[model samples]
Target: MKRRHFIGAAVASAAALGAPMLRAQGRPRVVVVGGGAGGATVARYLAKDSAGALDVVLVEPNVVYSSCFFSNLTLADLRSPESLEHGYDRLGAFGITLVHDRATGVDRARREVTLGAGGVLAYDKLVLAPGIDFVPGSVTGWSEADDEIFPHAYRGGAQVALLRAQLGAMRPGGTFALVAPPNPYRCPPGPYERVSMVACLLSRINPTAKVLVLDPKPSFSKQALFEDGWARHYPGVVEWIGPDAGGAAVEVRPGVGEIVVAGAVLRVDVANIIPAQKAGAIADAAGLTEGGWVPVEPLALATKADPAVHVLGDAAAQGDMPKSGFSANSQAKVVANAIRAELTGSRAFPPRYANTCWSAIAPGDGVKVGATYSAGEGKIAAGAGFISQAGEAAELRAATYAESFAWYDAISEDIFG
Candidate 1:
């Protein structure tokens, strides 16, 4: 039942079971591992588009999915955590099989997936959308084991709730320290957006409090937009340190609630340590990873190691796309089309992908960065990018914020339904 027992168990299982499991009812079966934005969208699409021609099975350990996309809003009291939770009951109407179990391993040779619940699923096509997992020791003196004292709140659900509770209990005039991760992590602008939201929360209740951002990178997504917003709204409240100022040199002591930046120790009331990340363990279990991510062909998102297995979302190392939910949902459509074309002989069209990441800096104030993508030069290449500019009109910013709300509703429906 161990999730990491991949190669040895898969090889033994393949040897014992000489023939691949027959497709259910003689229809091509697509097994999607992970039920986040990418998996749910692709699953719903395949079932809806194929019209019962293909059997779609989605394997996810959780019955309810809490999105990390807007969890920051919860911290600022703009949204409640319960509002972010979505159940899978709606997907049942599509005739997709929902397996509430963790995918332990993938047997590429036999085309079977091992589940933690002691079951196996055979698939003609396998999709990995497991998202990101933290890299061990990426942040010195901080680890997942110490997350209780210093919550990362990177993933949705309990962790976010914990961080929110800690923030709520923070003393007046306290310091909130955030350790941002490196490039190629999920939601490039997420940590910064969280900082903005936190500042908004504290500005009302704890005006004397401080927000510290320790970033390993020199600059981040939507840097100008965020910096300008911070200065205008939360002046003298947020301080950001980049790599040149030893932002990269960080160490935390959860026991004492202390963090060392550039060999200087500071005690903080709350610390959100977002460490480096990699492809989820399931991708590694399938032996499809390279350089902490799954290398995928641009057109269909198929893994370089095996064409039958496609990687999506944060787990995929496809070029030019920031690891965001919008990007994943966009990639899912392309993957769905390519998968359906191959499995059910459906008409395939040229793949076109798009993504827009929106960040709410303050109440009714939002900024965004996005791009369109297409397959080129063995990778997903960016084209026609757009971003929110500094010094925008308040009405436009409010409209942009309203647009993000609509997008959240639309995309959630598109994913869970």
Candidate 2:
């Protein structure tokens, strides 16, 4: 099939069947908050799969979504940030209402969502996929205001462009320092992959430059694979300090461009600080968060706080699933299927989830880790998984990088067309 026609054909086929005779009198409404991977996929799937039976609405603050999945490539100059931007016109074409506004509050008792622009939307089913918000004061001397000097760029968009500019402006032979977040944050391997990209860029423009990573966690996702790739691809250019080595005991002075690690001070030319994150503010307002994240039933992804409200993506504390775009996309499908079955009396199958996280170590070097999951004891548990091994051939790594690009295009089409 031609790539251009894929989304139109899918929507046309679903509409052709017409909506299954709705079980309820009026059309049920499903309001999705956030328009990233999880929310967008659920909103699109719910509307597309149900045809006209469900009134699907998506609330997003931005018209264009800059994906964090491949924003690292922008830093490496392998891809442009503009290329990562996606619009919602495709969702609108599928008959889903797109509301360009921030979701400020969720009135669970009234079953409505309050928008920043002063409107309330009532929903029979509400899916909160609001992604993550940084925990205030999680990183010392760093706030949203400091982002201009020390770019986190974890959420992509403008922060990514800022970080890219900082990298470009760095002095030759200078130091670039990164503070990686602990576990349970979005994209477990993101910080490491970012380090690789930074090294790749610095190696070309400033071969004498150094890249330092201070990670709060003792171990990281794809640790061995990334370490091996760093050694072979950009030897002696990168260094990592784990928690055992006082990585967790670090503070930054963005004004002075200085970092204190384990009581020792080091001056750096650039700093990227990724702090602890929690569910979006609306999730907390709705009482969906317990330990900084929303807990959900594995099978339906309905929030434990309120079954009428489903949570997906980084905001969801689904055990064993890394908080990556791919994970959110996978979880959205399961939630959409469950919601469809409930609203239309359609057949519902046991939920099965799958995710693959691909990290580009350099221009032609990529590694991946993925798993298939199933519901067990109220949590999503990993069943089988694969990880790139050490000492793989260069051709295989190149193929893996190509696969990541293909997956990005395919998934973006599936979500936004």
**Clashes per candidate, residues 3 or more apart or on different chains:** 0, 0
Candidate 1 Cα outliers beyond 4 Å, as residue runs: 1-24
- TM-scores of the candidates in the order shown: 0.95, 0.94
Per residue, candidate 2 scores C-alpha lDDT tens digits across 1-417 of: 111111233233333544222213377788899999999999999989888778787889898999999999998999889889999888877678777788788878878787776666677899999999999898888998999999899998999899988889899899999999977899999999999999999999889999999988889999999999899989999999988888998889999999999999999999999999999888999989998999999998999889999999999988889999999999999999999899888889889999999999999888999999999898999999999988989999999999999999999988785
Give residue 200's lDDT in candidate 2 (0 to 100).
95
Worst 10 residues of 2 by lDDT: 1-10
Model 2 clashing residue pairs (backbone):
none
lDDT accuracy of residue 141 in candidate 1: 96
- Whole-structure CA lDDT of model 1: 0.90
Report the lDDT tens digits of candidate 1 across residue range 212-282. Answer: 99999999989899999999999999999999988998989999999999989999999999999999999
TM-score of 1: 0.95
C-alpha lDDT score of every prediction, in listed order: 0.90, 0.88
